[model samples]
Target: MNISGIDLAIIAAYFIAVAVIGVVVARRTRSGDDLFLAGRRLTWGAIGLSLFASNISSSTLVGLTGDAYRVGLAPSAYEWMAGLLLIVGAFTFFPFFLRSRISTIPEFLEKRFDARLRRYFSAITIFLAVVVDTAAGLYAGSLVAQVFIPDLNLSVFIVTLAIVGGLYTAAGGLAAVVYTDVLQAIILIAGTSAIAILTFGQFDFSWSAATQALPDGHLSIVRPADDPVLPWPGLLIGVPILGFYYWIMNQYIVQRVLGARNITEARRGAILAGLLKLTPLFIMMLPGAFAVSLLPGLDSPDKVFPTLIQEFLPVGLTGIVLAGLLSAILSSVDSALNSASTLLVLDFIEPLRGEKLTPRQGRRYGTLATLGFMLVAAVWAPLIQHFPGLFSYIQAMFAYIVSPVVGIFLVGFFWARGNAQGAFLALVSGHGVAALIFALVQSDIIELHFLYVSGLLFALSAVLCVLCSQRFGDAPTDAQTRDLTFSQRDLTPEETPAAWYADPRFQAAAVVALTLLTVIVFR
Candidate 1:
């Protein structure tokens, strides 16, 4: 575990380079549009890389490996399923978002439904994103940091992460986040791929040897319906629902797509992200799946990534991998900070103001909001220790909060007969359903799997939306529905094939093919 002088220097160089990027970006940022949407100049390449980098958080790296170590490859379902969901977003949501020219995800709801619903959506997104997603990243990154430098205090690490990432996010806004995220994505891919290669070498590159003496279900993606870890039914129902919510509806993740210059760029970015999503199955999760035969009897599964880093990889490479892991933490945290601030400024504050603030004024407020939320998340991050584990903490939290939101979006978008009352009811009642399930599961009053519970709540929410729409109101005028709902434009031949590679149909086909291949190979 000892880091050599060269390794430390390489790590230091990464930090300094990141700082320089931040300063350079900060100088160029002035308007709210520049800060929030990267001046709407982001290309597909940056958007795709940023999307992947932001999503592959420190928590994702540590938690995916740890979950693989503890249970099996079940956790990789979240990663793989994400690719399919992103494709869904590319076809269904991407057109509406770019055409609407909106900044925040909730803004679409406002056009489709009403302001109250939009406000409600924004509140839920901001709260969960900052409290759950951002806090978890800080806590996870701090844990990984402590592994490399035992002398580093958790509080110090959390605060340092918040401040360093926050300064860039506050100053350069989405531009800095996306730009820095590209570097982060490369580092993470390179470093983690190298680790996977080295780990495979331990078994003479034989899958059989690496999986030797593995526990039952350790290499499985499918499991019994009643399986506590990840039931097979969860894969069919809950995983797709949650993945849709994350890839299509979530603000922090979609902010990259939102910043893309056009639908073509956004579509391309989404496809690239979907392709990258397949990597963790090989590079991150499977190593821990196979590590059972090598590094056994660990007290906690969450230690899998750190333990692997300690066991293999030469000194300089270890530092690089560690830096990549930390980059995930930074990218995710900064995305959350930027997004929470965007929701606050765009959804909450901007509407309330009588006279809109000047662009400079808006940028200033965004910086302050980012700093404030950064502090809140940094201080709150360590509270995750009270949970069972990092991955479990995130899964349970998302199950309860995000599923209902997804349900509302589903009905609100697809059903033209859907009314605002129904959408609002779905949002409120849906969460009520999810919360009850969460409580029952915790009290052991219900034996239902968390994933199944999530699926049930989402369905319940969708049904509520339907029934309430029938009762409370009539359908919107066709004029009111223009460009918001799926139109003939979505299915046109030009877009249908869209060069085969970029087409949503082909992208979805590839995702399904890869997913089936994975189940066949690993299950």
Candidate 2:
């Protein structure tokens, strides 16, 4: 791959601009709340774009395309199901999160259950963030950078990316992250859309031409019960459970929503993100689907995306797409660093000290934690190269961690009878089941899709939550149950929207309708 001077200049300019934005935002970040929650002043547009950017990491740009190349469109179910799930979050969990005014999702757990559950969940989240999210992002980004500069060592690039993302994220916190995400999201969408359009043009702008050479069922989002990629049952059962954990509960994605000004802002931001989620199926996944015809016989499915850029894109245009790819990578890395640090300082250190941290102390401790996680993830990032594929490695780990927590959160939210004792038992016992299932499947004693495993784990956890609460725990007092549990009144807006379209319900309905229309078109 030849690198043009124009392309190098463009990439350099992008880095400088991002650094400047982070520095500007850091000036205002003087406290823990400022660093972790953006002073709770974020609006709908920033929240929405940041959510979209943070989730669509470099691994996603590479993995989504690569998996689509091998497995067809079934891999896209994870991307689009998220839109519907975000709508569910907007109406259900978003209100609880906003009204409660908690900084971290673990803090919400502590309020609903106890400090034990909060710290437990926080420890697991920090581990996943560093080991999975940050490391994977660094690996994917470095992998792509290697494509452009073939001589660059993977380990060096991984460390370089980690340091760059870590420095600003440690400096300014969530404000820097979301603000830069606004820029990154725009670049990512534009660059991917360019590739998608140009790839389709290779088929003479005809859908039939694009599909004519592909395998049967390559365009379908739904698959048979025995399908290897994603079985239909897994689509219904496993996808939602994983999506709920990622969109609604994961501190990495939900922290921006927690930063919103109020419930209305948070709900509207989530709806906006839901709408953005639908675009990836068209702009990101379909490009790879089209590439099945445009550029066939690539040795690695992960090479599908970069190969498209090199083959079809002109030199200057290739630079723009490359920058977007970096944006996607850095966005995820920065969010993971910031969120993990937030968990370390607020959930663990603050609790240990038995007092609240001042803004200056918060910034000092938070910065130290951010840098520590960044180094740890950087060290682990290059090791991911040994995995069979980037996408599966990331998804497989999440399947083990998420189901039990999702089960406990849903049970505790809706059922006040679900006490701390049941919550603890459900988490521990559910993970116990997960470990056993993983071993059985690994030993060839049993066979189950990871998605099906998720569904199974969720059911086991939920039932245990109910049974344990009944047998071992007494009913919670009013103080324990009060606003922590769900109420139908939370769904009703306290004041009317200025216009009907301004209503969160209307926006949520519109996003849902769009998601269904997408399925109908692809199904």
Worst 10 residues of 1 by lDDT: 490-499
Which stretches in model 2 have alpha-carbon errors above 4 Å?
none
Per-residue C-alpha lDDT of model 1 across residues 1-523, encoded as one tens digit per residue: 5788887887888888788888998899989988999999899789889999999998889888888888889878999888878877777788678878999999999999999888998998898788888999999888877877799889888888889899999999999999999999999999999889999999999877887689887888888877887888888999998888788888999988888888878887887898899899999998888778778899877788988988988878987898798799899989999999999999988899856778998898899999999999988998888888776677788888878778878787777888788888778998877777778888988778778878988888888998988888778888787777776565432344536675656666787688678878877
Q: 367 in model 1: Cα distance from truth in Å?
A: 0.9
Model 2, residue 108: C-alpha shift (Å): 1.5
- Candidate 2: worst 10 consecutive residues by lDDT? 387-396
- List ranges where model 1 is wrong by over 4 Å: 491-508
What TM-score number comes out for model 1?
A: 0.96
Relative to the true structure, how large is the alpha-carbon lDDT of every model? 0.86, 0.91
- Among these predicted structures, which one has the highest lDDT? 2
Error of 2 at 499 (Å): 2.3
